[model samples]
Target: MRIQRIQAIAISLPLIKPVKMSFEEVRNAENVLARIETDNGITGWGEAASAPTMTGETQGSMVAAIRHLADKLEGLPADDIPAAMHRAGQYLYGNNSAKAAIEMALFDALGQARGKPVYELLGGAKRMRVPALRLIGTGSTAGDIAETQKRLAEGYVAIKIKVGVDTPEADAERARAVAASVKDDKVLICTDANQGWTPDEAIRFVKGIADTRIEFFEQPVAAHDVAGMARVAAASRVKIGVDEGLHSLDDLRHHHQLKAALGASLKTIKLGGLQAVHDAALLCEELVMKVNLACKIAEAGIASAGLMHLAAAIPSVDWGVSLSSPYLADDIVAEPIALSGGYINVPTGPGLGIRVDETKVRRYTREV
Candidate 1:
């Protein structure tokens, strides 16, 4: 089927609670959706969260970018995702979040036409289920430790502690307390600073937590300073990871060459789309870096479903997957992807597998 039409819809969805990061507090999910229709009357949907701190794309900018790209993509072959994406890159540059939305919709449509799951389109599934990483940041040490215990009791195999808000020593104490609460040695404990600290501060934090079982520390310094990341990594006994620093395969290679990070947190919004994430995962395997697949702080079921497929098809997920739908008060899919015993199963049906509820989409939709 040939491409027919494309439209961008902006929405604001409430989060269950505010997620406090170093740079900002997320009270609601501001996202953009791409709806594509083929000449044969089949429709596909894709989504991207507006992460201004991470991707430099707000909801308004993403909507405008998609509208500009839609004109360049219409009449192109719907199944030729790569070619269409190349065309989009030629016309627009560095709007990965907007392009991710368009690319996801194309994959959904192609999978439906081929009678296969999206994972199959991404080179088939290496595994059917992945452990879901829970986030624990209740704004206090006592509250964070309590939440960590609750997550462990609920069977979460991985958990991430939000730090970088307080002094390095204080955050280190909280990380220690939370790590001590998890009796299971196999449970993965990680932390993300979201580029909230100076290299010296991050070094101090890692040194303070030297006695703990924390697996890795992520994006401690700024995204632009690879040298700062390297300095922190050298001072850190715990493995270091990159989140904001990684935008392309070249970035990955640069980090590896500089010994800046031992692993990375992969997000579609950062890399552009599913295909780009897959390529990054392969490169990580070659470099022997651990992989952590994640959706942004708050995405709905469409983006979460896309994450599940990538989790299933990626070579490895040593750091686990962070699916964001669970953080939302409600989702736009008819059947949201629910976590069971702290794990998620990949959707096995055609296209994205979950049905989009147009009614709910409209309810959440807002003018950009």
Candidate 2:
């Protein structure tokens, strides 16, 4: 099947509740929706949730890149996703969210055409369901502890604590508080600093929480300060992981060469889309390192479904993924993701396996 048309939809959907993170407070999901229609009359949907503080892209820039990329992808064969995406990279640089949206739509179309899920296209599903990580907000100690307690009760194997918004002492206290409350032997507690700390501050915080039994620390220093990250990894009480600091496979390779981090969290948008994420995860496995599948802060079903497929196929993703399903106000799909006991089942049908609702799309979509 050949690509016939591409449409970019900009949507701002309110969160179920505002989530204050280490970097910024997110009140809603600012996302760009990519709609691709093939000549064979197959339609596929994808979402790119723009996080200015994280991915450094905005809704306006994402939409612009989407339009330009759609025009560039107008006449390509749907199956040649890599080629299309590579051309898009040449057309525009660093609009990963836009490129990811376009690539996802192409994958959706390809999967639907082959009568398989997107994961099957990348690699066959390794499991039916994958466990998820509960990311607590950067709120008060009591509130954060309560949420952590609740998720632990829900049988989550992992939890992510948000830190670095306060003093190193305060952040260490917060981490210790959650660690003290979580008594599950199976639960692995982690922290995402969102690059909120300097190298020295990161060291101080990690040293302070050395007794908290943290499984890993994510993106402690600035995103580009790999040298600083290396310093933290060498001295940290726990493993040092990174998310925002590593974007593409090249970035992953660089980190490996430097041994900059213990592990990494790969998002579809950060890697250009489905294929790239799978490739990166496999590379991490070969390097004998942990990989985490993570989605944007607040996601619509399209993005979440895409994430589920990737998580399902990657057996190397041992730590568990962080998803925003429970935090979104509503989803654009008719059937939301299935979550039971902190485990998410990958979609079973063709393509992304979630039916997009035009009604919700129209309801949530707005001009940026």
| TM-score on alpha carbons, each prediction | 0.99, 0.98
Best by lDDT: 1
Locate the minimum summed-lDDT window of 10 residues in model 2. Answer: 315-324
Instruction: Return the lDDT, model 2, position 315.
Output: 62
lDDT per residue (tens digit) for residues 247-331 in model 1: 9999999999999999999999999999999999999999999999999989899999999999989999999899999999999
Candidate 2 residue-wise lDDT, 271-331, digit = tens? 8788888888988998877998888888788999999999888866776788786788788
Off by over 4 Å in 1: none
Q: How good is model 2 by TM-score?
A: 0.98
Question: Which residue ranges in model 2 land beyond 4 Å of their true spot?
Answer: none
